[model samples]
Target: MNAFGMNAFGMTALPTRRQLLSFAAAALAAGVLPRRAGARPLDDVVAAGRLMVAVYRDNPPFSHRKGGALVGVDVDLARAIAGRLGVGVEFMELTAGEAVSDDLRNAVWRGPVVGGGVADVMMHVPYQKEFGLRNPEAVLFGPYQREGFALARNPMRMTQPMLASLPDEPVGVEIDSIPDFYLLGAFGGRLRERLVHYMTIPEAVEALVKGDVAAVVATQSQVEAALGDRAAGFPITPVTFPGMMASSWDIGMAVKENSRDLAYAVGDAVTALLEDGTLPEIFRKHGVTHNAIPVE
Candidate 1:
């Protein structure tokens, strides 16, 4: 018996399309709806609507272009995150070294970059003390995986004595990477004294295949992917670092300092997945063997 046939509860009006969509998304997350109603949290995300996932597309097996689609471990993870949020995924190709470059500094996702807002979150970021110190705003997610490098060699050439005597062999490594740091510093500059150095890990792999060098030290992921694919005939194997040379590292999604709310949410999401064994299951499907890195 009130105005517009509404009661005296001060009824405002019908729900907007955006509100309807938002409610639906929350319902979907809560499992109240089974159809995955829509891919939009509120509205179709036609405007102000995209979760940009920044990643390095070149270094394969992590983030890369495969089958004309943006794919890899990081890619799948990003899609899953967006799907949970009821949002569409947008691939933002990026790398770590160029983090402070003009492109990144001016990148824009939500608001204006002048305010130092985030354009996208970087995925598969290695936990580095220097990076954390420099970008106090940066936050890493759970240790999605524990990984290390090893010298893969042909089984025919493998021997316990040869493995033990590797310090004297010419080794290949990339410039300015963990391997380079380990070999140059941890190895007592032994690579220079014994193993030959390569401009890249692949170069070293080539050297190993061609017998140019005895072995090359590289990440397990890189070694596995390369050898599994085009390098199938190489007959490579792995040798984990001896003892606790370096504590295992946890790599995760990297969010800007300003977007702490988003960071915390994402971090929590990752941690929850780890706790429930979801993340590990995905890694298993990808054939990525790793240790679960707990998120504090």
Candidate 2:
């Protein structure tokens, strides 16, 4: 059903600003956080009278820290959910070394021992069924959206070839990522010599900027994030790739395992948020127009 059509329960649209604030306050006092996804955490927050959420500030399109506050698509959706649950949010700004896979594992998976465990979950996290399998404690909650991927060239490089001469130039990808996997499987070792592996896209772009490679592969979202994340100036122009080859991926809430009830409740809230216009609006604001979940 369409978002408007699904709620026959006579629900009020969106959430009031005040309920959200109260929810955040209650969450912190109770000490229920992102990784604390069991019924135990939910019950704790319920007793404290609010849900506390930890959000990564100013990640753009996903979540962001703005003018001393946190806001973004994920923030909006999360806030709306908090309101539905009568919970509160406590935003946390997360700093990570590389947008690489390993760093992500270290921060989200191994972070509870440190003060970094403040928030409940991270935003803009891409989901993989395989990843969920390996990290049994983690839950992939929703298929947020699919994004555009391209092979970009350094504007100043004369060695980078045009689309017609694509095979002659090598493509650079972060090692051990889907992009690298795709290239290897598709080319059948023909272009392996031209394949360059960097630990992260920023490093791949660095190689490209130094005329070390022809193209640096990245998603549109990743590329935009890289522009701000990198120390050196931007250096990639989009090039088309095989549409069926790793064209789509998932993004969802990653929570600790055995938290089925939490996942269901959070998923239901997410479902409701998506049914409303909030989810699409957040996507549009973030330049992420691709839709993941269907309207209820």
Whole-model lDDT for model 1 versus the true structure?
0.54
Q: Per-residue alpha-carbon lDDT of model 2 for 2-120, expressed as tens digits?
A: 01111111111233365346435534644553453232245555566555454444445466666866666677777777777777755555554223232233334434323344334
* Residue 242 accuracy (lDDT) in model 1: 43
In candidate 1, what are the lDDT values of residues 1-296, reduced to their tens digit?
Answer: 11111111111124446645743553355343233111122232325457766776565677777777776777777777666656677876753332332222223222222232334566765554543553344555444776655657654454442335564556666555555555665544455565566665657676777877666667766665555554555544455444433534556556655565666656676777766777766665555655665436
TM-score of each: 0.63, 0.54
What's the CA RMSD for each of the models? 17.2, 13.4
Which residue runs of candidate 1 sit more than 4 Å off their true CA positions? 1-49, 98-118, 128-133, 161-164, 167-169, 184-190, 193-203, 206-212, 229-247, 275-278, 284-287, 294-296
Q: lDDT of all the models against the reference?
A: 0.54, 0.54
Candidate 2 lands at a TM-score of: 0.54
Poorest stretch of ten by lDDT in candidate 1: 1-10
